[model samples]
Target: MYEKVINASYDPIFIADKDGYGIKMNEAYTRVTGITEDQLIGRHLKDVVKDGIISESVSLKVLKEKKQVTIIQHVNGKELLVTGNPIFDDKGNVSHIVTNLRNISALKSLEAELSRTKELANKYLQEIKIYQKKEDMISHEGVIANSRQMLNVINLVQKITPFNSTVLLLGESGVGKEVIANLIQKWSTRSNKPFIKVNCAAIPKELIESELFGYEKGAFTGADSRGRPGLFEQAHTGTIFLDEIGEMPLQLQGKLLRVLQEFEVTRIGGRRTIKIDVRVISATNKDLESLVKRGEFREDLYYRLNIIPIKIPPLRKRQEDIPLLANYFLDQANQKYHLNKQLTDDALLAMKAYAWPGNVREMQNLIERLVITTEADDITASHLPFSNQTAFVPQPIQKKMKEVLQDIEREMILKAISEYKTTRKAAEVLGISQSALVKKMQRLGI
Candidate 1:
């Protein structure tokens, strides 16, 4: 029965020695890894699977813990959930790692099929407008913004909501990227269509293809019984939000780039390519420029999706919007808690001064806490929570010769002053004779 379970499992199973040598592999492993049982046996496990790109600490832990660990692996163009477990000897020490690799590329195919069903359901729904608006979460009823930057974002979304163009939201994590994405879809022409979301970072690399463009049954072993539709097919005439687009593996980047260019997709092990009319919108908080320069992300793909770039300025950059967002939350709390929620001027000021590394999302969580904890409607500065009082950081500007010289001078003076207690100490800190430092300082007009 145990052997039957192992053989019947859909996921690939591998047993490797402590040093990373494969001792045994299941049939599923052969189908995905392309390494036959005989060939895999006694081979270096990591060598056979280069896509894993594991660190030394991982191997050590697997051996030491005598426990199990799961890793999301992207090899070639396939995605797999590889779970490794330590095998113990008579002394209870870990001897080998019995790992299971489940190829979920096919699962994504299933998701695509499921998505089509969702679209068909949409077509038959009553009050299509109301249902679509709710489905896409279009209303800004719950969102709150006080700062000019947040206001600008609200304004931009309001502007684009009436249009049918592809939208790209750029910002850091915990910045309500999804909130903005939902708002865009809720107000777009395809609101009646499925607002399918695909997180590029969450999906396994190998499975990204199937997740994006599904696969046919028997296209590969462990696939669903019925060949499934891809996300493109599921989102036909609808909208698909590709979040964390930067984490997509390079090989799949080509596939995604192709879909964006041709507006079509083909399934794995399928004969014909399927044409799709879905509007493609993507969001990312990554340094895509650096990725492109390093040959990590495709440049062509970047230009294609960046058509309607909506820069969701980080909360730190747009500090002015915090109060509005806070009030929106307070109104929400009033409705929920049946209490008149309010904040004092000092409290509001304190919130405005803190550095929001997590952005709007972080702010939201903090406000919720304040709403639940505070007693007074008019919350005071003492009621507010913050580690320090600092305004937003200034964005970097690429200036020409004059600004560069001034920046250089400012940095030197600041560093010198900081290192020393006074101007004399600062002069000494520069390491030049005091007279030379004074002369240079005068010349630079510092």
Candidate 2:
């Protein structure tokens, strides 16, 4: 029964006597080695290796060591795992050695295939992450402009997208200059490359140089230990948006001009200059021409940047686009806050009437505020947040043209103040003398 069970086993099995001669072998052993049972049963283990019938025998090693052994054996161009164990008699002497062999070629192949599959899965996951990041960066559904002025700006953006030229986006604060810059990058030929944004006004003046040009190790105090690449290096073969370019210090303007002219940057502490291929897009609410006249900005840099100037019209100038922009913002607010809200005709009229001092950004904020604060599902003129009643909806008895013009003038002066740092700057932006602006501010109760 034991012999029959051994012969029926799937794994190759061999029994060798203490003298190292094969005394018994299963049919599986003959099938694996291509040696018949008659030829294998009485063959010495060392004689099989000498005759090249089998590779190194584990049974011979077990007999010599008087212990169990495991070895890899190559036979007939196939890999096999061979394990051998010595059986002892009553006097503690070796009686025979039992050996088992298993073909591991298919198992090894399966293992290699599994490793390759895991690597491919990891690569796909990384690609998904990259695509998700790009989606987040480029998605801007709120930038809707139907006004002729805005359409012209969009047209100019489309025309210049195919070429690599410096673009200077001039607009009032909250007029969506950043949104336009992102659109240019998304539509450009280098859309697949990186789009790096740097707010010159937001970054500290002391650190702006290193942040734009990168730094080697120990470049300055509190610097990264391993060194770091700056925005210019990161934007190689892509686009770098310099938001609020008017705020960059005069000292760093020369360095920036050099980069724009030579297409190269030198690290803050390193001596070597690295070449880069990048498109520059700069935006600002301030008047760069006035800045140059005041010696606050570089004239050479201004000409280089103004190669492709795109002026995004303020909300007041594009009142025709208010309904579309308002509805879009309203929908966004409802979706963001998980509410179902609609704008009444009165509410839409009120939004169109009001001079959006904060422009699109202010409109979006007002919509979100109304969506959250209003008790009813329908937003009416009463839900608007304006101090002046006439600002929300036009009255049946219209004011004189002079009075209407004064109201528009008041709103512009206030907006200019909110957009600029000082009264002089605000006056320059409003195209009025400083004394006249101050007098107007006092009369309007601003």
Candidate 3:
């Protein structure tokens, strides 16, 4: 029964006496090593090694060392992992040594396959990074960042999108801070997750808390009977954009700070907390540092949200991008309204000269308005509405010098008329006759 049990094992087994003479062998030994029973049953292990049946003898090492031994033995062009464990008699003398052998070629093949798989995985990761970089360079969602400042901003957005850190966007109103937030979400790993946008300034102070952290059923008057999840809850496992974050209430800012610290929120009328995984992005035109100094904003929350700050440059500073933006908006408006309105060189030059106080938003709206309202195919400098004389100052050495001068004259006459109520008073201020003023106004389509 013991011999049958030992023969049942898949691995080859050999039993040797104390002096290292082989005493018995399992059927697997003959089947795996292709050695006949007579070759090893009565032979000493050292003689087996000398016969070249095996390159080494683990049983002989076990007898010499008086302990277990292991080695790789080459037999019939195959590698065997052989381990010999000694059995001691009552007198602590070696009674026998039992050796077990297993083939290791398949394990080596599996290790090679795993190494190739790791290499392929790394190659795919590098390729994905290159593809993502190219995608970031192409504009999305009306974002045309041609200036060096805006390009740097885009690059920073790309670098930080992989992380879950909070981002604070600082810029003047209409500088497209919201657009940058959208791009951040679009490029992130959570792109398929929910995206919730809330304007802190738009909501009333009394309801802002409930609008952010949710409430239980019947928590307040006019509350829904079944209760509702707030914007933060709805944005779980995704991103939340807090627009105009500076306008958030002071009392509620403490709760927001808690949420940021704990990654959990308690409803207005419930004690239970709901855990969330959300990436926060905030935007504010107001100066948060000034607000903090005045004690109007929470200092801790400000620092928490400002982990990564991106300040978008206003339109006036990046005037070089004005022409590109103007043409882009023009094309967009034309496509939407199915109109063929085109801006002439004088019109573009005048636009670039004027300071766009309202930034990209104002430019986009104005272009759409021009496309809809202008009747002629070509919109010239005379058709522009920048009526301030200082803003329409003539530039030196221009292709359309005559048109530029005419625009300046029109701006001056309009300013004078706006300051002095009557046309007669405006003409006197301009040192021109009323008839000449009116004729020039008509000619310039003022």
Each model's lDDT comes to: 0.72, 0.85, 0.86
Off by over 4 Å in 1: 1-163, 375-378, 387-446
TM-score of 1: 0.54
**TM-scores, all models, native as reference:** 0.54, 0.58, 0.58
Worst 10 residues of 1 by lDDT: 387-396
- Deviation from native of the Cα of residue 78 in model 2, angstroms: 66
Query: Residue by residue across 1-446, what tens digits does model 2's lDDT show?
Result: 97998999998899999998988888898788666766567888788889887789898899889999999998888888989999999998889999998888877998899999999999999999999765433333435767778878777877999999999999988999999998899889999999999999889999999999999999888999888999999999999999999999999999999999999999988999999999999999998999999999999999989998999987866767787888888888899989998998667756665766678999889889989999999998778877354552433343456656766676566556655859999999888899999998777555
Which candidate's lDDT is highest? 3
Per residue, candidate 1 scores C-alpha lDDT tens digits across 347-370 of 665665555667777777777777
Ranking by lDDT: 3, 2, 1
Model 2 stretches with alpha carbons more than 4 Å out: 1-142, 390-446
Clash count, candidate 1: 15
Residue 150 deviation, candidate 2, in Å? 0.9
Q: Name the better of 1 and 3 by TM-score.
A: 3
Across residues 1-446, which tens digit of lDDT does each residue of candidate 3 receive? 98988889888899999988999898898887887888898998889999998899998899999989999988887778989999999999999999998876666777789999999999999999899765545455457877788888889988999999999999998999999999999999999999999999999999999999999998988988888788899999999999999999999999999999999989888889999999999999989999999999999999999999999987866766788889889999999988889998768767765656678999899889989988999987777777234564554532167766665675576566656868899999999999999998887655
What's the distance in Å from true for residue 248, model 3? Answer: 0.2
